[model samples]
Target chain A: MPGVENCLQEAMAIPGAIGASIVDYTTGFPVATTGAAPNEDHEAAAAGTADVVQAAQSRSLFVSAVPHDLLEDLIITTAGGYHLLRLVRTDFDSRLVLYVWLDRLRGNLAVARRRMQTLADELTTR
Target chain B: MPPAVAPSRLLKQAADDGRTGALLVGGAPGGTVYLVRGAVTYAESAAAPGVGELLTVSGRLAARTWEAALEAGAGRGAVGHLLYEQGHLTQGELELCVLGATYDAAYFALGRPDAPAEFRDDVRHWLGDVVRIDPGALTRESRRRTKLVEDIFPQPGLDTAPVIPVTRAPRERVSMTAAQWELLVHADGQRTPADLAQLLGRAGYATVLELRRMAALGLIEAPPPATPDNPDFVRLPRAHGEAVNRVRPAVPAASEAPTVPIVPSGASPPAPAPAAVAVVPAQVTVASAPEAPARPPKLARRKPGARLPKEIAAEPPEPHPGADEVLLKRIRTALRALR
Candidate 1:
């Protein structure tokens, strides 16, 4: 089965992609690296994005009305680029996030989001 | 000068030599790092709770079962195997528990500056190693875990201090995970995180991670002191009591109504109009919970001597965008104008 490296390769193949990484959210380090790391260290980026993921997730837990909402995907649109973070569930306790940075002008956000989801499902250890 | 030897190299040498033994690392406060033919099969450390403890303390595996394993282990070992075969735990669970515990122990054992490593050849653990990990990989993974905790939640003693749940309700309602709910019940502002970890039989790291998340949500406060002189004194009462008094339309503390007028101080945003506006009792989800009748809107009870603001601070409370309170205020002003 395709693993961390395979996941990163498929992610880098996305159109307009700059760099793709599979980061262990707990450590904020990319488990496997391909091409160049992001503008900032991918590990640091993972750490920052993890804060966002955890904060967003806290919302679903802090209310009784809403059912448990897992953060499936996130897209950040910046002036320079599009950043996508996908939460990849695993059989183990360790959490992983698949991140791809794409050129905003050239990349399609919808397509990127869909592709990342599929990669995450495949990357998950069954 | 000769070059220094790497930890991984020592492990490689052991495998190359076909060594079958426990590489005893440290004593008392330290742990043992085990190697079987150059592979890291098992590890033990004083820094973490044991795999046996982690499983049994969780109340999943009883003491008698562990005792049985030990008794059977004397002549023919693999206590873990015996327990699993007896259906005390599944194969997957046994492996995960041992793996997690071993990794946790190795993290502390390898990083110990005070405890020096000592090797003893031709030795084995009673339960034995569950899986073999590469020495280099183990070092890298352990370091990554330590750094991750330091980088993300750097508050010193965040894990060592007692957890006190926030008393004042910041939001109208709160939610928690199943794990969080169990931890919250045991918080009690007494047991430190590690103590709670052992009590719950959860990994020490996992417990701390949840506590950090809880801190982010303002559900719990990381105590300023390791041993607070007066534990309850740490934010004993909510400081927002004054704000609650100003904003609440009619939050009745006791049965008797307050004499203050409906006009609220400008500093405070208006509280949600009484539950009468919307029947929001406690936001509890369980149908089995005894249903409480919706409480009327809580009114602000001013201090006995506090006087009302002369101008009645007329601008909408902080201009909350598209709020029902804003709409309600505009309607109230229009009615008064008609007068």
Candidate 2:
């Protein structure tokens, strides 16, 4: 598994990737980050998007679901770009989520999602 | 700039000068704020949870593992550094953990401008400096957190007051966040937010935020004010706002009940079944508080050999109930340490 920095490097290597961060949405903390801001407050975005992640994973939302699988990834499409959030499954703390901002014009969302899933699987915490 | 010389400005000044060591801020629960060349590395308040606590709370590291890590990092600057080096936590995780812990501490530790500021040069926290927080930003964040709390509860005094759950609900079927549930469960009407944080080994801010949310919803009420001559009022000095009533119990009348001299103060936690006395952890400790009227002692019924139910028996002999509770809590901490 690629290390944390290596994973960020890999994500940035993807075409049109501009920013990446590992945030513990539960605590509203951005554990790690790479890149420039997109004219918005990174803290606000980091804190606000947490609710989206929480709302999606809430048990109430899953009450009538056919699939028992927890959320794998979340994608937000803006007018200029896409904000892809890939939730990392961990034994240590379940709060960590990987967030990447991609340029919609140049980045391929499907490819970024697949790569993030692989990274999440390989990621391990002692 | 605010007229009073704030700790944040002092921190900013220190950062500009590129100084290193720990700044011991003054307050009731004053604390140390660690800086590495002006950037805030870590901070701790007597009232807030530290990173070490956060690590131990979730059972993240086993005892042996923690001991091994502790041993390996012996004489090193910070155990958090060892944690990162050993791959126990990624640098990202480590920084984030420290940031969360430090901010929580700074919120309480730095707010008092009047509190004396003592800078200890060259002192380093056991966790070392994983993240370097901009002093200006840190101040902004701390202020923001304070504002957030005010927005929710608009009262700072409750942070130290015991939580008393509302006897009657304002509305039916109240929904709450998970953190709120934990805070309410541990509220025990005697322990304040800081006490609950220490007991639960959770962040003080987490407890504060959850408690304030409850206050906004009217799920809980402010603790009854301490009596003017209350000894604990003088003993437990609050640095923030009003003096805290450390001796305030969920059932104030129960403590005032006739003392049964036969029971030992060190008695184990009373059996949970006693409906007569509510020792149910902090929040709901006194369902009978309103119903139980204070009665003058009828000395005729009590003999030296009378057997009392474990409920009232657990705390009857101790004249200083607060001190006894502290002792019992210490014992519980010791037992947990052994485990």
- Strongest candidate by DockQ: 2
Task: Compute the DockQ of candidate 1.
Answer: 0.05
**For candidate 1, lDDT tens digit of each residue in A47-96?**
67667666665544433445764668878889988988898764334455
Candidate 2: share of reference interface contacts reproduced = 0.11
lDDT of 2 by residue, B1-339 (tens): 233456776777777888997776764455678889889888888678666556655666554555555555534655677887777776645655677778888878776666556666777765666777877767776776777788888767677667777878799888775667788877777787888887777777767777887888999886444421222333333321121122234345355343333234434433322433444334443443343234222332333454442334443131121234334434544466687
Give the distance in Å from residue A38's predicted Cα in candidate 2 to where it truly belongs. Answer: 3.5
**Residue B184 local lDDT, model 2:** 81
Candidate 1 stretches greater than 4 Å from native:
A59-65, A103-106, B1-106, B119-180, B186-203, B212-339
Fnat for model 1 comes to 0.02
Per-residue lDDT over A1-126 for candidate 2, one digit per residue giving the tens place of the 0 to 100 score: 355677788878777889887766664555556885456567776776677787776635652366556677889999889999988765332367888899989999988888877766665543
RMSD of each: 24.9, 15.8
